[model samples]
Target chain A: MSSFRVVLGFELKEYFRSKGFMITTFLIAIIAVVGLSIPRFIDLGFNRSEEGSSSREFVTDNSRVIIYDRMGYLPPDELLQAYSNFQYAGSEKEVEEAVSEGSADKGFVITGPTSFKSYIYNADMFADEGAQIGRLLSYGKARKYASENNIDFEQFKQTLNPEISSESVILGKDTRGNYWYCYALVIIIFMMIIMYGQMIATSVTSEKSNRSVEVLVTTTNPNSLLFGKVIAGAIASLFQMSVILCAAVLTYRVNREAWGGLLDMFLNIPLRVLGIFLLFGLFGYLFYAFIYGAIGALVSRTEDISRSASGVMMVIMVVYFATLFQLSNPDGIVIKVLSFLPISSYSAMFARVALGTVTLVEVIVSFAVLLISVFLAGFLAAKIYRMGTLRYGNPIKLGVALKTIRRAKKQAKKLAKEQAKEGIETANEDREER
Target chain B: MLLEVKDLVKSFGDTEVLHGISFSAESGTALGLLGRNGAGKTTTIRILMDVFRADSGEITLDGNPFSAGDHWIGYLPEERGLYPKKKVCEQMVYLARLRGIHKTKAMENVDYWLDRLEISEYKNEKLEKLSKGNQQKVQLAATLVANPEIVILDEPFSGLDPVNAQLLKDVLNEMIAEGKIVIFSSHQMPLVEEFCDDIVILNHGDVVVSGRLKDIKKEYGENRLILSSDNYSMPELRKVLESQMSDIVKIDKEKKNFFVLEQKPKVTRERILGRLLNSSVKIEKFGVFEPSLSDIFVAKAGDEYE
Candidate 1:
């Protein structure tokens, strides 16, 4: 424990004083804040109106009627205000000109048969609703005129809305804003575990390379030294990721009404994922920390740490990407398999739990696998650590390490055989003397 | 004994390395562990520090075997270790703190050591930025700062140019005076002579020679002697002494006008001189010579040091 404290203080001091660590922490916080802000911005419905900059829709030619129909939800006064915001264009050239000249956010042109049902938009311009408006107005007017002239208007008018309905039903209990809220919870946990695991591995490799492990191990046991590195690295990750998460939540709170459902989701669930996150985080930490510590010992230098850890890291990266792929296609065989894997389960289960698709049995199975792996990894790691502590300079060959363990077992067997033979010989001699 | 080792044996795989080695060192005495390359000097140190478990040997300190998580042994491995990026004081205090010293006390020890080592200005300097000698000094200070009961240093003089060697020698001398049970290994034979009271030299994983430096030199004194005469045939005298002391090791030779010899218990040096005088031999420059530890080491461990 004293050694662990020594190394812990050593590691924390180094990291805290490092320019790279400070810069990285700052950068990660920025990226997370930006990423979170983007989703909340999506939730805000793009209203720059908080700055009192009202959004407007522009129309030209006969396209005004289509614009009016598409935008008919506003009252007449609001519609008049839309006209003030709008600057009409007579031709395609004029529409482009208006958009280019900052007179319009979007531009449209209308040209068609008398029924008038075509829309054209410049690639650079926003969506065109002019042709849609023209069609609506012409058809609305023509139908009204036809009905007044005692002609049948049944075919003249078509339905304004399409006939389509879709619904999502969550299988388990949920607090709402359902899918997105669940996804956010899942992504955060998945990112944290994987990111922090690599941090632990990288830190171990670096310390080993510096021969810093020698000084550290002298004061602390293998477990505590490794534990501190893993824990400290995780704390750094959590700090970075939390800054981002908080920024996003604050953004949502500011635009509370616009993101009312999201707000409700936050308040209702209070990120139920947080509890599971903390639990799985601790569990997975010990699990991955062991793998890192073992792989770290196998390499003679820091450069080799990356290569030595490559096999496991590749598996982890693949699992991470696979979990991401399974997000949109949950319940696929691959996703199901991932949810069962100890390494992949953190990501997969978080994704499912966020999506409200996990069950109690599945969670239990995941935890069991995680717990078992942590124990086994720790055991194997401790052995490797004990052997590797004094084993220096040369890289530890997998074969040699395996052979050492085998040789130990062989020596035991050989000793036992010798003892047995000696016992038998002594017994025979005793009988002969008698 | 403060530290004891009995029949310690260690092997790597199928190869038996250290075979039933035994030695003990009491507190307040520095022991020089001498060995050639791959001689198990390092292996013994490792076993003693509990870095490697012995195959069959037993080591007990203060009447008890090693206990798990007992943080008492202080080791300075041949390979230097200091967090290059950390400040000297920072790393020193942390190391001191680990050995059960309070943070404040750790800092106080650091300050005193920094001043004692004459690099107090470097207390805040990064280890990497310091001169190599200064770094070595810090490492030395680190080993003793913990006030460990047993301290093991391997090639402690490595990387030290001559001046640093003197500084390190002084520090070691100080440590010895302070009653640290320091077990240090060095290839420099003369150094082993200067510092160690007891030494065990190993060759090929076995103890080839061990004990007090003076006693070994005294044991080699069995046949060595000096002689002078009034007048005698130099050739005849050489022939006679060579025939007489043939069993004793020859150190050097010139002519028998006056020659050195190892006096057998029965042959008194005065009696030999009187006999030479009676035989009409001229006597000059006759005195017994004792070997220095370095000379003795070279004499016994021979040729391999080159």
Candidate 2:
């Protein structure tokens, strides 16, 4: 047990001291700080736009509108009621001169009873309050026509537009916003596995190529060495993730009001759902860590690390892509089946649960499968590691490595049994002599 | 006996690397594991250290079963290395701690070994920064950091200069004095001759010549004689040696000025000396020659050693 601790301690020290680890952690921290502060910057920009719109509202409300009744189809009091804070102009030329002199924000010239043209400082204003005034006058004309024809005004308005509303309900208390956070977490897990898993493999291969493993194995159990390295890699990755997560949470907390309901949605993920994320996150990492360690052991040189780890990398890719595809169709039969698979369950089942498309029993079952697979992978990896550490030169295939491990284990057991039997025979002979 | 390996049989795939090889060493002595290249010396040492399983073997320590990990056995493999990027003192402490030494004790041991190896200045230096000879010394220090009871070294003197090699020799001597079982394999015959009390010469995974170094040398009878004279020219010495000897098994004088004659079976050293004197060869030096370990190795391994 102390040997185990020693291995773990030194491996972690090596990891922390490595340049790659430090550089990657620093890069992630920078990205996290930058990622978290983006929303605040965006909110500032948003508030600036809101302030600009509010000032525009004050200008449009207080500014005057002048009317030139050239056709004489408009009455003065009704026109005044139609356009508040209006000034009567003597001619169209006067209205234009007032607009040019900036006395009015807009000008109205009554060409006929139902048609008019306006002079404005900007074309964008034409679509603004001017368009609203046109619609309102048109409605007034329609209502007058309806009243004269003995038609119901309310019925006429209802004919133009009808009332409609929409609402959605899932099986459980989950929002579309929850899916966003779940998916982000899944992507985080994927990226971490790739970064740290490769680190573990590279580290093991470095030790092998450096020939330090020869001395290391003689001092401690090879299994302990493998586990120590894998766990150390895991801890290092988790530490980086936690740093980034804390940065994100801190940034969000400082600007909670600006983030609004989106931040609340992420923060309000049920405790149960968070529990599932933790379970699958930890177990899934362990599973991949074991496989990566085994691959590292099978390869003799650091140059072969990537090529050897690619097979396991491909498996992880499959799981990640399946989870991504399943997120789109959480209720599909294929996705439901994949959710139960140990390989895909880590992300797939978690996504389903986050989307409120899975039951409690399914989560429990899938989690069990994932946990069991982690243990089995750890077992096989330890065996391959023990057998592979001593065998050097060229990368070995997994099949051949497993076979060699089994053979070596059998041979060791036989040797032990023979030694035990010889011991018993010697003891019996001594008894007979006595 | 502190350690014994009896009839160890090891095979890799279908090829038998060691067939029933056995050797034992007691405390307070160094056992020289001698062999030509690919003579199963490493295989034997690896089995003794339990790096690999022997197909058939029973090793005992103090008349009980022995397991490598369960014992305080220090090993320096033929392919020696330390973590090149790791600090020397840190690596030593880590390895020592793995061997179950307390942290404080391990650090003390590391400091002592670094000082002993005259590498205290390199305690904080990365291994790659050191010269090759210094790196080798650091490896040696790491091997002894745990203060193991039995030290197995494979080719410990391979890459060392004379000074460093002598340093290691002195350390091996100290280990033996402390009642540690020291077994090491080396091709440097003179070093083995200098320090080894017993020797095991393996040939093709078989122990062809083994036992106490002096006893093995004695077993190869001293039948050869060298005659040196200050006055004798090459031709005159040849004539004198030819006339004075009968049943001369072999004569090799063209190689040098002195006459080295291997007498026939049952020939006594005194008889050869008397014959040379009776002929008045005016001998300046006369001695019976004992075969060196290399000669015995060549004789035993034959063309393989050649």
Candidate 3:
């Protein structure tokens, strides 16, 4: 086997054998399973209306409402029909006193055909009682006007409240339906990048600090060591994430009816969207993993990992927030531009595919750019890792390391050219001698 | 087979660490690489292992250019470590496989080395759980797990007790007997003197001395003699020499029962022996003075010692 494969195999075995990795993955998968299966084991009242109780009955079951009408527009019979918990009061002052003294949960006084005053001891942010009472008063006034004008009240009522049946025909992507899943995917990729990236960096720094890198470098080339480590990390993290996601999606599908399909936007993800997410997420992870590995090599101690990786962390954070903010407007210029950029495209392009209209060409172009960037980053990281292998003591700054690599490359090119020149001259001298 | 490193020059950035260092080692013999700290011993070894490219150099084995990737090289660096949290056998196999050993062979080599080093019982144990000496043994096992044709040991005797050190010496002897090329580097001069057939002493990235151990010692021992008398103490012997043989010999070092004498210009050993016999001093031991490897090392590379 090649050295790269050997190193990769060892690293993967390390991950699989690690108790922390196994336990953490199991715990998160269990959490996802239970969280998605919650509706099956518990009653969330989503089907309450199917049990023969209207929303009004459910909301006003035991609450009392005191009413006082100054204009006498609302008849008591009509008001009682609408709200069975209603009680009459002679004056608005009486209604207020009734509410204040806790005799009624709410009180309303009708002042005009479409206006009302509400009284409550403590206001509830979600209360819609005033709007309900206003509608009732408006109906009462309309009935009275029809009766006085000698028109049939029933016909007038039918004319005023006509019911229409309609069905929606979505012509394009259902942004509202796909919004939650895209949002979730964006966050997942962000977290995976940050967490696994740091872990890769820490592993590299650990080897350096513990002085195992000396043996490793001699045993295998730096490129093999670094690429193997990074690819192993990416695979391990992706495995964990896939387990958790598959658990959630499968459990949610099994209990979709129990949840009344309320979480469909999040759990009922389309396969194509998921495929895009995996592609972008994996490549994005490998790109950052290489950078993180290089950063790890720059530092000689594990404690210096965070300090060395802070710049990369900042970039990831910025990309995360930008992608999240543009989730609702996936078709906007910000998201469109971000979708083509390598660093942001992992999340941005997926979001556009999920919630916005995008062409296959756009996706192919974005992915191509990201793939190229990944390879470039990998090569640079391998170079930096090779340069930093024997360096110890204080952490070398990334800028300084890059400068050194550039200078070395220039020198190597010059030496190669000189050698070519020497070869040519030696050949010419041989020809002359012959 | 012979491994020859000719004009090996290496530099990091603008600072050249190895300046045209040259040495050669043959199969079935051990070469001691002696140097003070920062004398570029590790640098030279790294270049040989292809960890770093030389600024300018040529290395060959049996008349062909040597590429480290094509050969199995077991290198135990001075700053050596293994995964503390990993099983000994598992990591050893991993390291062996990195050198292109198949899994079955790697496992066999790991087991063989672990058994040879007397750490077979700890094969499944985490490295950190072992005692320090046992961990060092595991490190040695890791180095030899690939059954490499060439073995480079840096400070291999450090952190080892006398028994363990002897065990390592015996193992090294077996490798040499097997016709493996061995390069031993250490600060413990006596160990190197006991095992190595040839030596290269480096000072400030330069090879100050390179030759066979016997030849170097013979060249250093010229005109120097160790003399001891049964009847006279070292001071008494020195006094006698000062009084009767001052022109013939000069006392170099005075010890409890012996005197190390430097023969004067054009003086013969026969002349000294005849003069001592006439002086009536009972000569107990007399031989040419051979300098210790440590003495030669200190003489050549001591100025830069930290």
Order of quality (DockQ): 2, 3, 1
Worst 10 residues of 2 chain B by lDDT: B246-255
Tens digit per residue, CA lDDT, model 3, A1-434: 39989988889988888899999998999998898777788977554455534333122233698888776777666576567787879999999899999999999887777778999899888977677677677778888899889999878876876656699998888888888888888888888988888888887787887788878877887788888888888899888888887888888889877777777768668899989988998887788888898898899988888888889899999999999999989889999999999989999999999988899999999999999999888778878877887788888998999998897788667655765676689789999999
Docking class of 3: medium
Q: Which stretches of candidate 3 lie above 4 Å from their native place?
A: A47-159, A267-272, A328-332, A355-359, A410-434, B11-16, B230-236, B239-244, B254-256, B280-282, B303-306
Cα miss at A317, model 3 (Å)?
2.3
Candidate 3's residue-wise lDDT over B239-306, tens digit each?
88999899999987665577778999999999888988888689899888888898789878987543
Q: For residues B1-306, write the lDDT of model 1, one tens digit per residue.
A: 367776778998689889877777766677888777888888888777666666765666675664424746567876677778778988888878877888888888898888877789999998999988888888877877776766788888877887778777887777778776778888887777777787777777777777776787677655566565444466665765566544442425333355546554567666665655564345665677565665565555654655
Q: DockQ winner among the candidates?
A: 2
Q: Write the per-residue lDDT of candidate 1 for residues A327-374, one digit (tens) a residue.
A: 776657777778778787766766566554667898888889988988
Query: lDDT score, residue B12, model 1?
Result: 83
Which one wins on TM-score? Answer: 3
TM-score for candidate 3: 0.87
TM-score of each: 0.76, 0.82, 0.87
lDDT of 2 by residue, A1-434 (tens): 78878988998888788897788877877787777667666764423334444333122233588878665655443455455688879999999999889999788787765888789867673356556456545666777778999999779866875555689775665546677777787898899889888888877777778888778888888777888888888888898788778877777777665555346656666787788888888888888888888888889887898999887789888888877766767788877887787777777777777774677887888888888888787778777766776678889899998788778878889989998898899899999999
lDDT by residue for model 2 (B161-207), tens: 99989989999999999989999999999988888998999989999
Residue B182 miss distance in model 3 (angstroms) = 0.4
The segments of candidate 1 whose C-alpha lies over 4 angstroms from its true place after superposition are A28-45, A48-177, A255-270, A325-337, A356-365, A375-379, A390-434, B13-16, B62-71, B161-179, B226-268, B271-284, B303-306
Better of 2 and 3 by TM-score: 3
Residue A63 of model 3: what lDDT?
Answer: 68
